[model samples]
Target chain A: MEENDVKNRFKAVVIGGSAGSLSVLFEVFPALNPRLNVAIILVLHRKYSGDSSLSDLLSTKTSLPTKEIDDKDPILPGHIYLAPADYHSLIEKNYSFSLDVSEKINFSRPSLDVTFESAADTFGPSLVAILLSGSNDDGTAGLKTVKEAGGFIIAQKPETAQMPYMPQNAINNLEIDLILDSKEISDFINMLNQ
Target chain B: MIEDEEIDLLLNDVFEIYGYDFANYSRASLKRRIIRLFALDKFPSFAELRYRVRTEEDYLKRFIEEITVNVTEMFRDPSFYKVLRTEILPVLGTKPFIRIWHAGCSTGEEVFSMAILLQEANLLKKSLLYATDLNPSVLEKVRKGIFPLNQMKQYSESYIASGGTKDFSTYYTANYGQAKLNEDLSEKIIISTHNLVSDSSFNEFDLILCRNVLIYFDKDLQERALKLFDESLGVLGYLALGSKETLKFSTIQARYKQLDKEKIWKKTM
Candidate 1:
């Protein structure tokens, strides 16, 4: 289905990435309308710290209200939540954050695979997953799971990514729905909102 | 909707035919893991994967690895180990016979780290470690007690951070870009295959380190694992979890006391 066709159906949007993710997030998140009813979650890699300042960093670039997710933070519309450093932030049935110190996958503790997989279990088909730029094959398996469970899948254009390994790996393993450049990815997000 | 019961049926078939029992595992995690494997094999359906797994032994091996959680490291959560050395050691105090269980031990990094700690604390002579996991593939590597040299730098940092008094290099001999932990560390270690879900406790221990494993389980499974640990821990035994994990919500939380602020719980009763 086209982005506009499924706009109102999704509960939330989830994006996963690693090494070369900042540029991709810069592109995709800005185009999302702050007024849209859907919330966005970004699971990125960072060192362990009590207060990760990622949401502040992204808020300067986008109109949406972004915040680093805290333990038990409610899932709210028009807000962007970046998974806090050093913990795998998951969505509970009550729409609250459930932080876990689960075993690492793909050598990362706050791994994209873990977040994407957990979100798929929570939201089911009402989820959208995007695999962006990164160096390793972290998000490939999780992307496949999201797609299988009725979620849409998008990948960054590998050639345009600073680190192509992750996008290429996911593209190699699964039939991704869209592969777009930064501007086009922004347009796609706008289209999803429309 | 794939009902939970159908998933249970699939898991049961896998265990009966392939000897890989994941039936009792947390349903959500088992579903995610199996779905991942199903995608990798390009099975048209979960049933198709189940059919092939029943007839193919190699598939069984691959399935075992897929279901098994292998992400671990030496002295992971350095602060926890530091607490173990400083706070728990004097309490243990070189018992005539000390038993330790490193449950869900993946490839044995933690096992070696514990052995080194016990040896340094002058408790090795009385200590025996039962290192276990559901996957036998990694147990073979644990038996060998070897790790890539590339990880040595990180492991060394964790060791020192965990309050090691000896040179990290003193514990291993480098050969062909791999560091083989000295044979002495493996001497008191019995590496074996054991499951937290399907298997019951076989031995009581003075300390049981089961970090980062319970978070994958749902509340019920978490409680189940805690009950097993509660049953397995000797009086006043120490139990450590991942830095983010705690005994707070589990059924056995009342039976244990927080050892330190680092998420270690001690059997209180």
Candidate 2:
């Protein structure tokens, strides 16, 4: 259960957050070692039909390379992948991203639950699910699946989150591993990796 | 019996008897619709529903309604159609002859919308619009080109938002409670039944509109339909989707570039 042990085991990291998530991303992305041999995937809830330039918007705040994943691109270390605005993006065992137009759940196509569950299934114990700021409890069930599969689960401290529905739901749904504010969260993630 | 098994059986029976395939549709939506069908048909059991659909005429009609997801209206998204008119039309206007495919055309409203746009753009004379859907009943209604006259008031507003140049009422004639579209409009369209899931591409087209249709399909089905669209589109052909659909997760995403964020993508080799 050591943090370094968790980091050494995972080949990649997966994070799910929404609503007031940009602040969390700014803190988290810069803390991880740029030289770590691990890829990062972030899922942010977005309006189903709006134009989203999240990857472009995030690129300016982090030194890590960021791009909206295209179909079947191999997941590589030193890069960050952002799911596009309206589709659920999944990672195959081959490390390529798969896009799906399957019917929406809870009226959203790019459901956090879809991305997190699929990632947990694909990566098993190597995966980490984080629920941050959001208006809905979208990632609660998915984060539970990750925890049940012996993966890591983290939530933003509800009082620190701009929208607390998501982090609070994750906490109420499962016995999560860690709950921290943005400052403490970055330090914990970095220390875990080291 | 588990609901999954019952749905599998229903899909099997549909394929075996009607030659229609629902096997590849997203499981959640398909299951929901089948449940609605059962409720509407008053079938006491899944077996009874299957038998009635297999044998009874009235049941088959009801089954078609449940199976076909026709959520559409005239100019459903005004801004998208606005872009289609201002940006897409100019490119389409250059072609001496144009063939457009309105895939998944439901109730013919969108096909008629495109036809009206073409007519105003001075391109209808040299244009051929093929409007297709999997539901034969909807296709038949589309061929008739008559819509409930009451809906015309709302459609007129959409038409204006899409940048109508003339009176929207001029495109159709009111008869009793129905509005019959201009014969000239119908002349430009060929309405037929074509299942995107089970059918192959019929011909190369200058533009293909498969809006709000793929969201009902699973990943495999979406990729199949995307490949079909890619092949069916001629060089520099255009592909338009519902605002909620995109090429981002398809195997062919690299083969397209967003012409507009509103889901207009141009075919790229």
Candidate 3:
């Protein structure tokens, strides 16, 4: 299949990261095209601060709609959804969101693998998953699941990332389709806008 | 790992054979939990899983427990508790007696938190804390009122943030790596097995808390559960839900007025 056809098949962009992902997100979020029609679901690991400010902070960095995910929220195109602290956000086959406060995987409530595996099961070929900068190997298994489901996978360049272990682990273990730097990642997303 | 057909098959078997209706629960969560249990238990095929659930009563207990999400904590969302302390309880304190129902109250962390609040307000004697869930084993834990010793540190912090005045340590005694709560707090609590999917409301309540439980249900089931709560709630009662849940989508939305930006609603009539 042609690359353009594959790009057009995408329905959601699920981004997973931890540790030093904040800096990479700031750069990429600011550059996201307002016209991009894919939902951006962010699964970032962090301490449970009893407030919903991360989404508010990211909303200031971009024009696209951004907010913390709630239970049973619909997955609308061109919206950004942040996984709430202390819960795992899941993708539903009906193109909506579901939440669980069950046991945390990999010491993180919003585990990347839980969401990624669910997204792969739900979205399958229509999913475009990106593994960003982090200090752990949480997203690697999720990326592998995404790839097995015929979804496209991208990893941030380890050398350029604030924390290299996350992307580096993926590059070492998986056949990532695109391993790009921050600027290239932004450009790739902008390409989808067209 | 399981397909939609397999999920349907399992749901039907559970209801037809076991008399527990879960067809109204959200398919997304049911699918995930079923897949997880299949993998964790190392069932060779879907057929094997069905056979065990059909014949073995013990496995059915485990299956029901897994399907219901049980993760809970004391004083979760401290700010929400803070509002309960300052605003909601003050009004409830004015009543001659108070009745609060903790529907789907898994392990009773939130119940303990509320009991503590009532005790602090000098209303524990007059208040009844009916903690109910579908799982009997979970209710056993609630009746015991013992939690991990290590978790108390975080619960203590959460208590302080929720406007608790006394030292949080006074509530429990730590021994054998478990903190057993005082009997006085659990005195007002009544534990029972109540299935929200099918059970009828037994008594009207001034406050009904079904936090995070309805998220596992489909939209129609959510509305059904909300209506059941409406039937069980008094005219001027309060209804609280999970932090991200709302009254906006349910049929009961019209009569309820939201309290500030919190997920709490007051039935105005």
Candidate 4:
């Protein structure tokens, strides 16, 4: 599919990563248009509880309004939602988020796989799943679900990732649509807005 | 997409037939669970599932279990238990008799964790732990106090992190891939069924641990539960919530004060 066709088809975008994700997000968020008509969900692994500073930090770098997800919060267009620490945020069919305190998967709560799989189930062909830099293979299975659901899948190029295991796993296991660095990812999201 | 009317009708039928009130639950979570049930049971549509739920006696039992999210572990959040041990328990020790309620205590992992905590603090002899849940099946499991042996390793780690002084293995005996918690711990525990949504508070409590349960409730229901908690707690009693949950937005927010970073709040008024 053409880039413009893919852009128009998308309704939601989900990005998952752990280590080395902050800098990449800083680069990508600034480049995206502020008024893009799509909801963006982020899942990043953290070692502690109550660290909600992530949303505030991201808001400073991006024009899109960012907030930590509250349970049952509605998904709105042109807004950025970050999964709160220590909860697995699932995208419900009603286009709202449900937080679960289930046992951690892949040794992480706010599991990348959990959010991506739920987003795939909810948005299906209209979703975009991005696997970014991380030290673990958490997003591979989730990216596979997105690919099987006919959603576009992007994996940060392995060499470009500060910690490549996560994106590299996705590239090896799934048929990813795009493999781009942080700058290219920024440009890709910018293109989607146009 | 399932229509709003269809969901309302289905929930009304569930309440009328099963006496389980899910009307006030967060709609998104309820809908997702229902959809998941439909997919899991291979029901073609919500109407078909609703028919089965209304008519089939055995199906309702499984349906209830499926809809209720029971994701808990022993000492699930070690820091919360740490706070209870280092700070809260010492204060509660001054009471003539301590009453601790574990609301929505699914399968009793945390309740057992609490029992162990109280025992370690030398308060078990004078303390009474009331563990309650909406699901009878889970309450039965709580009464038995047997957990999968595989989880003991993880539980031991959490126990240590929560400032356990004794060997964690001494609390339970493993056999046939299951660990039976020491029977002495059950002496002071009373397991019963209580619905936070529909049931009134049975007794005032010194400490109430209702962690991770409120996240499944909507704002109104959360307020209702909080009000119930406030009424059930004695003045200066402690209420422990899940790490992600907060009383800041609740209607009774001013009635409590944060006692620690681990989400322990004390009822002041």
Candidate 5:
């Protein structure tokens, strides 16, 4: 499949990471290809509850409009949505967000598996999911769900990751479609714009 | 395993036959929960799921409970509770009788937390905590005032974080891995079933906390619920929403003064 045939091919791009993921985001968001106009979602492992500083911190790294997700908030194109702390953020079928205060998965709220699996139910083939650096095994199962749903899956090249367990686990267990480093990651996502 | 149209069909059948209105719930969360229930019961097809809901009276109860999220904890957001203690409750204390309505009070965690706050402030006996939910199964738990024992450690941490001073264990008695909350706390609570979609305001209140409930409703339903809250609040009353939810876009925004901290808003008139 031609990767650049991505015009209208996707509706939302979900990015899940932990540990060294912030540095990778800093690297990727600075030169993002603006042509890619789909919801860019980030689910990261963090401790603080409802930290607006994280949004303020990430917003300076990119030009895309970013907001912390509230329940029932619409998932719009070309926007960046951060999952709030201490709740499992689930994407609804109507292109909106919902929150659950259920028990943690893999010792973390905002589990990548929860969001990716829910996003798979909604976006299906148009869902492009990316797994980045992390110490735990949260995103692997979610990436598998995306794969089974026929969504595109990308993983950070293990050596390029500060904590490679997460992306490495996906690469080890699932049939990952693309493997990328921090430098190549932005270019690949930007290429999806075409 | 449920199809989109089948969900609509089941929702319609449940409403038409049982008089339960879930048609306006935010479809995403509703569908996801429905799907979870379907798989948990191991129904092979949507038809079986539909048949069970329609034919079995007891199954309908289970279906409703599953669709509505009841996974809550005491002081789930400790900071929100902190503001409630330091800022919101202090003013409401001056009233002769404090009436608080915990709308969509699932499993009654937040209500108990409020009761603890009131008790700590030496106001529980004079306060009426009206805890309501659409599901009666949970209201029974609220009445019983029991919760899983394992959760107490986390709740204790949150309790301290929320500026609770007493030993948290003093609030409940434990046996067989279940903690029964103090009767004194439950003493002030009135548990009932009230559907936000169909129910009207029953009493005016000093503080109304409908946290994380409106997120499940569609825009029109959210507006309707907000209006109901407006009608239920007296002048200088406080209205609290979930952290992410706002009264800013609603019609009642102009009259309410948002507090400097938290999502609490005070009704000026």
Candidate 6:
């Protein structure tokens, strides 16, 4: 797809990671336009508890409003939604978020695979999924599902990743469209709104 | 894509035919699940799925399971169980007899988890755990009290993390790739089919656990369920929801006090 097509085709962007995602997100979130026209859903594997500081922490870094997702909360454009700890955040066909406390996959609750697969099913070809630095292969099958759904897939360049296993696994298992460093990924997102 | 009108009609058909109300469920979640079911069953469209749902008796049962089934595990969110063990159970132990309701107790994993906790506290003999769900199929599984043996490893880890007092292995016996929970644990549990959306509270309880089940409902249904919980709970009783669920946004928010950071609320009003 052309750069212009990339900006026009997608309705939502899902970013997933685990071990080293927060630092990368801190850099990327600020680079994107505050009023971008797509929903941005993030799943970063973290401890299961009520005292989540991620949404608060991300809100400080980005101009776009950021909040931890509540169950059945509508998915709105130009907002950043962080999946709350201990629940698999799924995208509904009617464009809302649903939380599930089912068994943890890959020993992580907020499983990237669950969210990515659900979002792929919900958004189909209009979705763009990015797999970032992490120690596990949880998001590999999910990115594959996105690819099968005709959505775009990007993996953070493994050589530059803090934890290379996650993105590397995706690249090995799926036809990833791009392998960019953190800065380049930010630049790509920034280009989407131009 | 199924239009809103199409969904509304389909939901109404479901209600009229099966008497299972999906009319007030969160539309987004319900639609997604329906679409998913359609795709999984290779139905041509939502209309086709709806036809089968209305006409076929077997399909209705499967469709209901597909929509309402919540995947759960033993001692999910160890910290919640930790708080329940250390802070909550002791308070309940002081009473003469405790009546606890596990509403929407899917497959009885958490029900048995609670029974184990009560047993360790020496309160099992005096406690009655009423485990209920909207689905009778899952309730049947709950009555058997058998879980796949493979899951025992994960449940054991969760058990230890949740501060189990005895060897977690002692709670079950493994055979034929399945583990049967001890009769002692199962004895305190009474499995029943109860719908939170349509059914009234059958018994008042000192503690009620309606965990991840509420996340599937829309605002109106959520408020209704909260009202039902409020009515069911005794004074100073306890209510526990899923980790992500909260009373903060509900109509009954002010009636309950936060007992822990893990979504345990106590009836204060």
What TM-score against the true fold does each predicted structure earn?
A: 0.72, 0.68, 0.97, 0.84, 0.95, 0.83
Q: Which pairs clash in model 1?
A: none
- When just chain B is superposed on the true chain B, each candidate scores a TM-score of 0.90, 0.95, 0.98, 0.96, 0.98, 0.96
Q: Which one wins on DockQ?
A: 3
lDDT of 4: 0.87
Candidate 6: where is the Cα deviation over 4 Å?
Answer: A1-12, A18-23, A30-39, A45-66, A74-79, A92-95, A102-128, A133-179, A192-194, B1-9, B39-48
Tens-digit lDDT track of model 1 for A1-194 = 65556767778888887888897787666676667777889898767643446778788878888888754567997788888776667766556566655457777868888878778878888888888888887888888878878888889899999999999998888999989787776676655666
What value does DockQ give for candidate 6? 0.43
At residue A101, give the lDDT of candidate 3: 84
Summarize candidate 2's per-residue lDDT along B1-269 as a digit string, tens digits: 22568778877877888787888775544555676567766777889988887877676766876666765778767788989899998998999999999998978889999998998998999999999988878888889999999989989988898788689999999999999999998888987888898889889999999887876676789899999999999878899987656788788888788974578998777
Taking the tens digit of each residue's C-alpha lDDT, what string does model 1 give over B1-269? Answer: 34556667777877787566565454545565676677777888767777777777887888878865576789877887889899997788756788999998878899899999999998987899999988889899999999999999999998998999678999999999999999998999998888887789899999998887775665666788889999999989989887656687777888888964777888889
Please count the clashing residue pairs in each candidate, in the order shown: 0, 1, 0, 0, 0, 0
**lDDT measured at residue A188 in model 5 versus the true structure, 0 to 100:** 71
The prediction achieving the highest TM-score against the true structure is 3
Ordered list by TM-score, greatest first: 3, 5, 4, 6, 1, 2
4 versus 5: better TM-score goes to: 5
Q: Higher DockQ: candidate 4 or 5?
A: 5
Q: Give the deviation of candidate 1 from the true structure as CA RMSD.
A: 5.7
Which residues of candidate 5, in runs, are more than 4 Å off?
A1-4, A34-36
Better candidate by DockQ, 1 or 2: 1
Cα deviation of B17, candidate 4, in Å? 1.1
Error of 6 at B258 (Å): 1.0
Question: Could you give the CAPRI-style class of model 2?
Answer: incorrect
Angstrom error at residue B82, model 5: 1.7
- Give the docking tier of candidate 5: medium
Model 3's TM-score against the true structure: 0.97
What stretches of model 3 exceed 4 Å from their correct place? Answer: A1-3
- DockQ scores for all the models shown? 0.16, 0.06, 0.71, 0.39, 0.58, 0.43
Per-residue C-alpha lDDT of model 5 across residues B1-269, encoded as one tens digit per residue: 56789989999999988999998887767887897789899998889999999999899999999899888889978899999889877888888899999999989999999999999998898999999999999999998999999999999999999999889999989999999998889888998999999999999999999988887888789999999999999999999998878886789899999988688999998
The superposed Cα distance between candidate 5 and the true structure at residue B57, in angstroms, equals 1.2
